[model samples]
Target: MSLPLYPEPVMEGPHGPPAADGPVNILLVDDRPDKLLALQAILADLGEHLVLAHSGTEALRCLLKQEFALILLDVSMPILDGFETAALIRQRQQSARTPIIFVSAVSDSETHVSRGYSLGAVDYILTPIVPEVLRAKVMFFVDLFKKTQQLKRQAEERAQLFREQAARAEAEASERRAAFLAEVSQALMTPLEVEEILAMVANLTVPQLADVCLVDRVTDVGTIRLVAWRGSPAGPVPLPELIADLDPIPLDSDFLVAKAFRTGKVQLLGEVPRFLDEISPRCDTGERCNRLVRLGTRSAILVPVVRGQAVEAVLTFAVVKAARVYVPADIGLAESLARSVVMAWERACLYQAAQEARREAEAANRAKDRFIAMLSHELRTPLTPILFSASTLAADPTLPEIIRDDLQIISRNAELEARLIDDLLDITRITQGKLNLSSTLTDAHRLVLSALDVCADGVQRKNLVLTVDLRADSHMLNADEARLQQVFWNLLKNAIKFTPTGGEIQVRSFNPDARRICIQVADSGTGITAEMLPRIFEPFERGQETSSEGLGLGLAISRPIVEMHSGVISAQSAGIGRGATFTVELPVVSIPMETGAAGPSSGEGGDSDAHRLRQPRILVVDDHADTLNVMQRLLQRLGYAVSTADGVESAMSLATGEAFDLVISDLGLQDGTGHELIQRLQWSGKRIPSIAVSGYGMKEDIAQSDQAGFAAHLTKPVSSQLLKATIERLLALQ
Candidate 1:
């Protein structure tokens, strides 16, 4: 057979080649067209594509175009026979593994079959081919092709799925890191003790970031000490000896914790064995290495807790007995936790400092209150005698007019000095919010009139034109009578002090509404300037022209007292020299069904002849000799039999032996307090009604006297009329 000089065109479909799952091609090669036709008919039952190649050259072309499951080649061909074609097909890279079967008529020639097998043929068939055998052999290769294609597709799908899962895991890890830092920051916002903050940091680090955690704090002396430590519950328990050894490891040494603290940088050991090998030889002994090995430390990270320019502490985290290893991201997380601990420590320190400062301020305030009380006592003790002597001498009708007038001035001035002292104490009470009030169903009109009577002398001295208008229909109020009198007196006194001679002073009261009553004191003298109106009620504040007169506390004390009674006090001025108007507005209450009898008026000597019938015997006690002597003589002049004592012992002896209707005692005594004297007397079966006459007139002092069984608490430098009225009332109750 002569071979063709050139190759023939191979047959193919319009769309290049069939898909992997589509029908596989089977090549049929022969020198004769009839032989190719016969071979095609025999393989037709296999239900797969069979391509026909007239010569070995055409068959080689077919292999180049598309893949095939098997090739059936005729042995004796004209050019490029089956053996030669198969050899060439095997040489090509794409079809090197394609299966081949040779068909020949020379069945007995072993040389021809041996040559075909040597060229990589699977089978040698004689001509007169069995159709079933041919079909069965072709079907086997077709099935194998389909299974191989299925495996390739499955592998590609699995690779794509793996990529997606890796992306999701990275995203989740980033989210977890952010959430952990946020949780640590929120917990550190509140004030926590330094040790507690360290413990919290260690506890929060385990299982999430590390298997073991250790926190070291720098002490006041600048030595780093491990303050808190924690380990995961699932981790192996460390030996007690190892923990003790770990704590004493000097953090300023060459260890990782010390290095991080000294440099204020993070230290990470990804492989503990490698780090151990590097450091084991430098150590004096194997003790440190043994501890690290026993801890099962696989990886570790150490970060410094830095504040300002200094490292305050160091945080250590370790992964033990686990496959996990510490990475760079863990170093960042450790540093974040360290910062939170530093902030918490700072806040706790500030809170402790603030608490200490508050305690010191309270102590100083208490000391100031004590000093004021003592000064008031000393000043009032001497004035008691002066006030008693002048009032007694001024009351004598036979005294010359000039002498009586001089004694009246001394009395008025002594009273004025006492009021100034009371103002000092009242301002203290106001600032402390401890002012106490004794409330009753009081008529505001009565208090205004009484205040007017007290200021009558000052009004006369100034020769000011005074107009009184009381027109309030609902003037009754459930209020503190004495405090209201003080408020009214302060306004009227201020008006008398500021008004020049012949200036008009008008006092008026009227109901602005049924629920409230307004009392206004208007002056036409040196009026307040517009600039001074807002701060007129602040303590120690005074008009520029009137700053030389008093302590400037009258209006300051009045506003709070009025507000305490559910009222408001205000001032208005048309400018200096025109006049100022001070108005007080107070809530009013309706009259009750029945009215109780009014208590005896203060400073009233209430019919001495009527008191002389009973001849009430009173015991007066005081540490001041002058005050004691004046009080005894004053009581005698008021028709009461009085005995005196200088201290608690003498007062007790006098009260127990004598038959007294009232026992009046000063709160401060040389031997003991008047509170002790009254209690001792009552314990001795005396049971006499007593009154507290004290220079210590703070509300606490008065409460102490009342609790000690005193019938009344009368502040020192008491008037004879007030003393007489108090004695008569107590004796009458007896």
Candidate 2:
């Protein structure tokens, strides 16, 4: 077998900086200057810094001042021999690793050679040394030191460049974030309209945050809507032309946008495969993918716009101009932008909803007011004549005793019917916040007694046992006395109505503390169930015990009245079949002693100033003939000259012909509204004092009446006494 030919080994110099500039140092230590001069002349071709020391002590002093690439010394010396000097040189930090060569005259002895090597000598040359060998060894170490310094310099330069690039990148990233947030904020301030906002977002982010952007939203019907899109700036056509052929991706589909929406997570694709067929097996989707690839889309991120736990939309970012990869920090910023978009969309939706609701509420209220007014007119028109005829018949003294008794019954039932109607109207006023309290310092105990007296007939009819304990002596409260009496009456009436025959109903009034007076009504009645206890005070909350026929508004009305007086009312019961206790607490206060007649009770008759005044002319306007006739007779009986009209046209005719001191008109007349009639009267230069009567007595209705120049507002089923008082008051004002 033939041996394979191999190239000769190359002899390379030690790697280092070029010797033409700063040369490396080599030390020569010898007692004889002639030998040093000889050694220097032979090694001068090496081009290195040569250092000389005459003795071992001189060599030690040289090593202390500077470093050397290599050290040369003669072994024989007078004081401080080469071995001791070399050992001391090794002890110093700067010259510890320097290479040393020893010269000797004697032939090589194993002991001498071993001792020189043991003293950290690199080489032991005999006398009559070859200069070529000396020069070659010295040059090798010098090259290594120079090469290390060069490498260190290159590393430092590279590090400075890297730091500069990093600082520039950080500054650019900060600027981009600031610009993005500022543009988005400006877009939000434009208008809350969703379409415009989405368009602004899509266009604003393109070529800045992304090369291309698309925004898609999911509709209420589970259908997707493409809000906005921006193609790459490199495209031959504009952004609209690029997106014109595209369609909304359905949420149930397997597209990346839909995936982000359904999963409510971020989807980042660093490299979208060039082949469309790999993305989808379907031919149609493959074609769409081909178009996107042609648009130069190489990378993408689909971030979901999350509102609460649900994903509302998806924001798509594509890099078309350059292939890019998103880092964790980039993804975090993308999600933050998605949050801003979600907030804008939600705020727009809420604003639209609030506007719609406001419009609907206003329309519904107008219709409700109209309905209540019409219904009141229809019901009260017939009741007016019934009440007036009964009153008129009962006042006739010449009638038979039996007939008089029957007439009395008719009058009583008619009055009772009117009272129920008034209760309904009161509930409407209280619920609509139209009722105002005329608060005064009054006796709570007297009001409680008065409420009991009103409920006396019902208690007797039911044969229910009643007990009274009025222990709150002179308990005066700053409250609406009439409203308080209504509260007391409601609780007592409920007890009488629900209690079985021979059942006990106890009414107790006492001061729980110095600041509060409490009234307790305990009854052995059909108790409220556990389920009903929580909602017992709610309006029309008649529980499963449905034996009652009345509208369940008594407790509902009582609660707000008590609350208006800074008081509280509560009910307690064990369960069904157990008795129930109702407690009402009102604040107690001091009042000055009085020696005169107390004020008349609410909804009661009183001496009027109208009786002292000359007979005043009055006009009654209503569409219902029965109402007109009844009102005319009642007012005439009160010694007023009264005129009646059936409609606005007729009323205007009568008003223009007659000089009336006061005008009382139904709000909803068949011809026109009372507001129109009053406006017409005012326009005609008439300043007659007017009162508005209607069942649509909400707060807004009263405000409208006041705005129309009506002096007072009264709901239908007005009492004869209340009407008389109102008429007298208006006449006095005139």
Which candidate tops TM-score?
A: 1
Give the winner by lDDT.
1
Model 2: residues with Cα > 4 Å off, grouped in runs: 1-145, 164-191, 195-339, 399-442, 459-466, 500-504, 524-532, 542-548, 573-579, 590-615
Alpha-carbon TM-score of each model against the true structure: 0.71, 0.60
Backbone clashes in model 1, listed as residue pairs: 3-79
TM-score of 1: 0.71
The 10 consecutive residues of candidate 2 with the worst lDDT sum are 1-10
When summed lDDT is taken over every stretch of 10 residues in candidate 1, the lowest stretch is 1-10
Model 1 C-alpha lDDT per residue in residues 550-616, reported as the tens digit of each score:
8899999999999999999999998878889999999999774345778878846555545557778
Candidate 2 local accuracy as lDDT? 0.77
The digit string of per-residue lDDT tens for model 2 on 626-648 reads 77788788888888898888788
Off by over 4 Å in 1: 1-167, 203-212, 219-223, 231-251, 271-274, 284-286, 289-296, 320-323, 436-441, 590-619, 639-643, 649-662, 676-689, 732-734
Model 1 alpha-carbon miss at residue 224, Å: 4.0
TM-score of 2: 0.60
